[model samples]
Target: MIRLALIGIGTGHPDHLTLAAIKAMNAADLILLPRKGDAKSDLLDLRRTICAEILTGPTHVAEFDMPERAATLPYLDAVDAWHDAIAAIWMREIGRHLPDGGSVALLVWGDPSLYDSSLRIAARLGSVAIHVVPGITSIQALTAAHGICLNELARPVLITTGRQLRERGWPDEADSVVVMLDGGCAFQGLAADGMSIWWGAYLAMPQQVLIRGPLATAGPEIMARRAELRQAHGWIMDTYLLRRERAAISRDAPTS
Candidate 1:
């Protein structure tokens, strides 16, 4: 039986690793880390650092080249195909390393329940006993670094992707939205009348950057800074939460 553990490691920060995640890493028979080309070598480096600090058992570490998604297909379709390819690569690696199928672990960036695919890939393993060790997420770090609560009292929060925000615009009833995986500043097109935004890039890491204020005023600044940092580092992992003001909500609502 394959005992698979999906361990959340957070945004490349050594401190962001939870004790549970560290334990899980040490318990695994094999650990797999994917290299997504030279542009994101930092990801592999971070995994290596984590392995150095945590893996105590006789665990074998392996690196596999991650497949890139084709840009020609529809967005969802392309992502689905990419994930399939990733699952195949993982299967190949696991078979090569642990033909007997023992305990294995993959260190995921941020919590697996969030915008991560490690858990999904593990599900494709079939009949495996799966375990999830939760760790801090980029959203958690974003809120903590900004020193703000995620949602207002008695309000619901919607967590979504950059693509959703850009394509659908703001949902009618959402007062607070946490946007992740946004390559473009989707919040810029938002009606920023009285909405406040808290943005952070590289959360919980040494190279963290933050911006917060009324969206109208801070939007451009965040966009400019995001571009600068992305150019400087060649990659970035960022998240932001936007809360529309009560007054602005009332103004946007039509009178009955």
Candidate 2:
């Protein structure tokens, strides 16, 4: 039986790796690293660095070029097709390296249970036993970097993507929203009144940048900074938390 372990590495930080992640890496018979081409080679380099620093076993490491999604197809169809291509590549690599079926590991960014689709891709490998090791999410990193709570006092938080936010506007009854995978700064479209935003780019990394204030004040700043960072780094992975102010709840109102 093939044992596939999807280990979350957390924001590409070596220290963010959990003990279980390390053990899984060392125990794996082979580790597959996907290179995202020259534009995002830094991502592949980070994975290599983590393996070099942590692997004490004789695990074989292999690198493959990642498949790019088709821009012409509709978003959902494009993503579905892209995942299928990735799964095929994974199977081909696994067969080539571990012909007899052995343990394999793929280092995933953040927890796979989040917006990440590593788990979904892995499910394509029929009959392969899978294990997951949770790691810090970008949301946690953003909140920690800003030193703020994820939710307002007794209020709920909603996590969505820039595409959804742009198309649907702010979700009904959701005061706190976390946005990820936003290539376009969608927050600028929203009415900035009574809203606060805490934004972070490259969270938990040496090149991390953070900005926070009323949306009216910080919205433009974040847009400019995001542009500059993307130009400098060739790519950027950022997430932000947006909160719409609500009626103040009395401190004595319900302790339970």
Candidate 3:
């Protein structure tokens, strides 16, 4: 049986790796990196940089072209199909590199438990022994970069995707919400009153950028900046946390 290690690398930053993640990389018989054309080649480059910096001794490395998703399908359907395709690709790669059933590792961006699909794809391999090495997540890096807590003290924090934020608006139960995979500027849909936002792009990386203010005041600025950066880099990964301040009651109130 092929031993698969799903190692989280975290937000395109080499320093975000934990000691366990590094050790997993070194122990792997094969390390597979996915290439998504030139525009996103920086992603694979980051993976390679981590290996060069951390991995010692001779270990096999494989790079494979990533499959493109069908754009005609609806978003969820498209992503589902894409994940299926990726699983197939992964099986092929593993078969070629580990015909004898040895340990293989794939470097994932951010923690696999988040919005990432590596875990789901691995399940498709059918009864393989899977190990996970957790790394720093973008949410953690985003919060730390902005020097803010993830939630109001004693309050619940909701972690969600950009699509959910756009469709459902801000959740009623969560005073604090962390948004990820937000390519559509979902924060703009929120009612800004009493709300504060802490935003970061490329968190924990050299090109890191950050913004924070009342959502009403900073929403437009963040939108504009996000667009500019997306144009410059051809891709962007960003995350943010939003919280609402408690509203004050009227001075003249009826006593019970």
Candidate 4:
């Protein structure tokens, strides 16, 4: 049986690695790293740097080129096909390296359970026992960096994607929303009135950027900065938290 461990290495920061993540990396017989092309070479390099820093034993490391998802297909269909392709690659690599099946690990960015598809892809590998070593998520990193709470007292917080926020406006009954995987500044599309935003890019890394204030005032600044950062780095990962003003809700409420 193949024992597969998905170890989360939070936001490419060496210090963000939990002790469990470190132990898992050292314990693995083989570790697979996906190369996402030249534009995102820094991502793969970050994985290499982490391995260099913590790997104590002779664990074989392998790198595979990632398959690009077809942009022509519908979003859901494209993602499903991409996951299948990734799973195939995983199997091929594992077979080539560990024909007799032992423990193998993949370094996941942030926690595997949050907006990451490593777990879903691993499930396709029939009969493999999966283990997860949780690391700090980008959400945690964002909130921590800004020194704010994730949710207001007695209010529900909705964690969603940029696509969802764009297609469907702010979710009803949610006072706070955390947006992830947004390449474009989707917040720009929302009605900025009565909203506050805390935005961060490259959280926990040396190149981190943060902006927070009334959405009306900070939204444009974030868009401009995001473009600059993406241009400079060739890639970027960012997330933000938006909270609706409680006073505005109270003012809009109809008297009983």
Candidate 5:
């Protein structure tokens, strides 16, 4: 039986790695890292740094080229095909390294239970024992960096994606919303009359940036900064929390 460990390595920070993740790395017979091309070379470099700093044992580290998703197909179909291709590459690499099957580990960004896809890809392996070592999520990192609580007392928090917010606008009864995987600043179009926002990019990294205030005043600044950062870095990952003020909620409510 093959033992597969999906260890969460939070965003690209060395400090983001948990002790369990470190232990898992040393215990692995093989580890896989994916290179997403030169535009994201910093990502590959971070993984290499983690391996160099944490791998105390004789574990074989392998790097593979990440497969590109077909952009011409419909979104879901493209994703499905891409996942299948990734799974095939994974199995091929694992087979080439461990012909008889052994323990393998891979670094996943943030908690695998969150928005990550490593666990989904691992499911394709079939019949393999899986272990998940949790790491700090982007939500945690974002909130901590801004020195704020995720939700107000007795309020529900909704975690969603940029596409959902862009298409549906804000959800009803959502006291607080955290948007991840947002390529665009979807919160800019939100009803910003009485909302507060906390936005962060590259959380916990040296180049991290943060902005927080009343949404009306902060939204444009956020968009401008986000665009600048993306242009400067060639890529960007950002998340934001939008909280409705009590007065705004009361005013937005319908009367009988």
Candidate 6:
């Protein structure tokens, strides 16, 4: 039985880690970092930097090659197959490094409870005790960078993926929508009128870029900036929030 610690590293920023995350890193017997090839070497490097800075104890660091998802298969099937492959890789890495079955840590971006899949992958490893150490989420970082509240008073905020936003358009249940894992800029598909948007790329990172304004006016700017950033970095992770005009009537509405 292995004690699996899924530690949130918080947007690749060293300062974003919480005290609990710091303690978890120091307590782990081994740390597994996934490498996503040349295009995402920066991510691998950032993981390395985090470990080097915080893993003061004699914790072993293991780097594993991440498997790519199948493009041909349907979304759900493809995701299932991809998760299976990742679980296999994770098991292999763990067996090779710590055959004795000890504490292991995998640093995740943002909180595991959000759009991250670390928890799902860990569930595949049966009989393992899973512990989550939460950290600052991209949503939190994005809102902070823009100095805006995520939701309006008496209104609900729906956090979803780009695919959902594309397929469902604007959800009627939510006046405020926060989109994650949106590689194709799905917001472009919706009508920009009466909607305000705040977008951030590489949130809390050194090369972070933020844009906020009316979607009609600022949407093109975000697209251009996103294109330029992606071209320069070879990869990009971005999130955005879109709110309808009526939601802004009372910005200071009570959240509780």
Candidate 3 residue pairs in clash (backbone atoms < 3 Å)? none
Q: After superposition, how far is residue 89 of candidate 1 from its true place, in Å?
A: 0.7
Instruction: Give the 10-residue window scoring lowest on summed lDDT in candidate 3.
Output: 246-255
Error of 2 at 129 (Å): 0.6
lDDT (C-alpha, whole model) for all candidates: 0.88, 0.92, 0.87, 0.94, 0.90, 0.91
lDDT of 5 at 98: 88
Score every model by TM-score.
0.96, 0.95, 0.94, 0.97, 0.97, 0.95
What tens digits encode model 2's per-residue C-alpha lDDT throughout 1-256? Answer: 8999999999978999999999999999999999998989889999999999999979999999899999999989999999999999999999999999999999999998999999999999899999999998999999999999999788888999999999998876678999999999999888887889999998988899999999998999999999999999999999999988764223213566
Clashing pairs in 2: none
Question: Whose lDDT is greatest here?
Answer: 4
Query: For candidate 1, lDDT tens digit of each residue in 22-125?
Result: 88888899999989888789889989998998877699999999999999999889988888889888888988999988988988888899888887777776
Question: Over 4 Å off in model 5, which ranges?
Answer: none
Query: Candidate 5: global Cα-lDDT?
Result: 0.90
Candidate 4 Cα outliers beyond 4 Å, as residue runs: 251-256
Quote model 4's TM-score.
0.97
**1-256 per-residue lDDT for model 6 (tens digits):** 7899999889989999999999999999999999999999999999999999997889999898999999999999999999999998988888898899999999999999998888898889898899999989999999999998889898899999999999988776677999999988999998776789999999988999999999988999999999999899999999999998774433433477
Residue by residue across 170-220, what tens digits does model 3's lDDT show? Answer: 676777889988888898887787788899998877778899999998888
Better of 4 and 6 by TM-score: 4
Enumerate residue pairs that collide in model 1: none
